[model samples]
Target: MTIPAPLNGVVPPVCTPLTPDSEVDTASLVALVDHLLEAGVDGLFVLGSTSEVAFLPDAHRRLVVETVTRHVAGQVPVLAGVIDTATLRVVRHAETALAAGADALVATAPFYTRTHPAEIAEHFRLIARRTGAPLFAYDLPVSVHSKLGAELVLELAAEGVLAGLKDSSGDEGGFRSVVLGARSRADVDGFSVLTGSELTVDSALAMGAAGVVPGLGNVDPAGYVRLHRLCVAGEWALARAEQERLCGLFGMVGVGDPARMGRSSSALGAFKAALYLRGVIACPLTAAPQLPLSASEVAAVGKYLAAAGLL
Candidate 1:
């Protein structure tokens, strides 16, 4: 399927289920896709931050795209994240994902090395020139350690180098700038501005963002989809109510003890545990080297699930 130029609605950053032995759990992964589909999400995002993309070995990342794209079969767009440290590596993953049937590729700014805005722009330019696939810039400064400036994004969008943006920078003003730029510029038509913030979907949509890429959507996709619809319909009051409820549900991410694990472990563990408790998957195990939630923490996840009426 041709991905919508300005793709809209909820697109969950899918979680990768792992076997205790640390292999990708294909069955659970596919089942998770079904869960999101049934909830009526507009698209599927695999190998993203929520999917443990940074931790996945190259082979497993390929497997994730192949499995999801093949299973989705064009029901909706399948976006594969070509997350890497630089341009050439991202191009390699982008090519592999496209070959595996992905409809578009989402990439982050070149990371780990100190980078300038010119270099970042060149990184994306090179990938766009070489891969020739629809590209979404993932502006996740928290992970990539570099912010994608609105002017730079607009320049690329005007040049046809970027098809869309996934802004997780948590800078509401900056996000609004991109949203406005996309709408105001004739040359930037079909440029999608998506917010990656679950906590601010209502605000983002209110400000003209095309859609959301909520990581928490993996747990309760229907909630996010409902919120999106309310926002799109201009029902601001109702939308805020629903978003607040989901925000409450999002509290589960903090259940793990901080002394024992980093934020990634706590957040991913909470989501996986909720999925397992909801019977969406067989196990809640995360990828190796990440600490698992303790029994108490898992119980905390259960409480959050219960409060959210997901259990």
Candidate 2:
């Protein structure tokens, strides 16, 4: 079967699986992917922020991407996070993924470089031009803090490129702007705008978000699937209540623990922990430098989960 594009159900931003010794464990990695697949996820993401992309070497990144591609076996689309400040590096990664028979690629703007909208547009244009493959723009302003304006995104979409965008901008107005821009224009392909933040999944979906690409969903893929089902069913009352609950869970992840450093440290590590608690993954061991959470925080999570009745 031809791999589906980004717009589907829920695609969990899988945490990078590691060994007890804190190294990339391929066997466990494969197991985790299969586990999530069996749990009802629509797609799998590798080498993303949650996957510890910065820590994994290029060879390791290639290994994870190829492994997912090989094991997924076209059951679902495998999006390798081809993120880098250098456009050439992203292009190279995209080319490699395409060669490995990957279904599609998810890339963001130059993270290290605080580039302008024009520069970001050119960067994606070059990658799209070079690969001639389906591309999704990752607008994660918190990490990169280099916002990719919705208008610029439309400009790329108008060029017969930019099929979708994973908006991690954490701005509802920006999301609305993108949705409005696509709905207003006839030239654009009604580009898919996915939510990268779980806290806003329900809201974004209500605003025409094609799907969600977040790490929190990795904790409870079923919850996201249920939420998506409800949203599609137009059960606004039920969806809103559940969405707020999930948002609360998303908030409970990291409450006063700087071990994971920034979002990467907490989002991925905490998610693996939740999966461990739920009996999905065995170790829940994230990449190194990710000190485990404090006992109090752990207890708080348990209480929060109990309150949410998801523990």
Instruction: Go through the candidates in order and give the C-alpha RMSD of each one to the true structure.
Output: 0.7, 2.2
Best by lDDT: 1
Clashes of each: 0, 1
Q: Could you give candidate 2's per-residue lDDT for residues 28-114 as a string of tens digits?
A: 678778777887888877878778887777777887887888888988888778888779999998988787767778898887867
lDDT for residue 63 in candidate 1, whole number 0-100: 95
For model 2, give the 10-residue run with minimal summed lDDT: 1-10
In candidate 1, how many Å is residue 46 off?
0.5
RMSD of 1: 0.7
Structural similarity to truth (TM-score) of each candidate: 0.99, 0.91
Q: Rate the local accuracy (lDDT) of all candidates.
A: 0.94, 0.78
Q: How does residue 28 of candidate 2 score in lDDT?
A: 69
**Model 1, 1-311: lDDT tens per residue?**
89898899999999999988888999999999999999999999999999999899999999999999989999999999999999989999999999999999999999999899999999999999998889999999998899999999999999999999999898999999999999998888899999999998998898899999999999999999999999988899999999999999999999989898999999999999999999898889988778999999999999998998898
